[model samples]
Target: MLFEDEKTNSEIAKMLHIGETTFYKWKNNPKFIKAQHEYAVYQFDSALPLAVKTLIEILKYGKSDKVRLQAAQIIFKRAGLFSDNGNPELDKAKQRKAIA
Candidate 1:
């Protein structure tokens, strides 16, 4: 019901002849809340491929360096090429210093 239809909570409750408070109370349950979060993640995962493709296009043909750099940063981050401090070079330098 939540995924198939984009109805509001009040609408869903009304259709089931329940009150708004009842709807909210049920929605606030831990399991129900988890399902909602999982469904949202599922929707985003389904669209992620298209989003990645568009970001690639922006990186390749963006009108300005600022825009292209931003896109490139996102791609790098998603590709697991970033370090904890967000700078791969800095991370390498730190590793070398620690070795020394």
Candidate 2:
């Protein structure tokens, strides 16, 4: 229940047959928090293929020019084409890391 997405505390508690306060208590536990983070990463990894496909689709055929450009910019940013300090030396370092 804790790993379920888009579920409110009260809703999850009801589904689990537990009190809302108990649900909150479990949510506050450190181990539970760590497990939640792991589960979220697993879920994201599982959805990554579809997410990449959607981004590519938007970059290719988005309705507005601005939207398409934004999508392209996101792709370039993720690909590390732009550097934060606008330093060519730093960009070359990153390119070398990618090649290595």
Could you tell me every candidate's TM-score relative to the true structure? Answer: 0.68, 0.68
Assess candidate 2 and give its TM-score to the true structure: 0.68
How well does candidate 1 score on lDDT at residue 81? Answer: 88
Report the C-alpha lDDT of model 1 over 35-96, residue by residue, as the tens digit. 99899999999999999899999989999766776686677778898544637787556545
Per-residue CA lDDT of candidate 2, range 1-100, in tens?
Answer: 5576688788989989999898889999999999999999999999999999999999889997666766776788889985466477965565555445
For all predictions, the C-alpha RMSD in Å is 7.0, 7.6
Residue 73 in candidate 2, Cα distance off native in Å = 0.7
Q: Please report how far candidate 1 places residue 76 from its true position, in Å.
A: 1.7
Q: Model 1 scores what on Cα lDDT?
A: 0.80
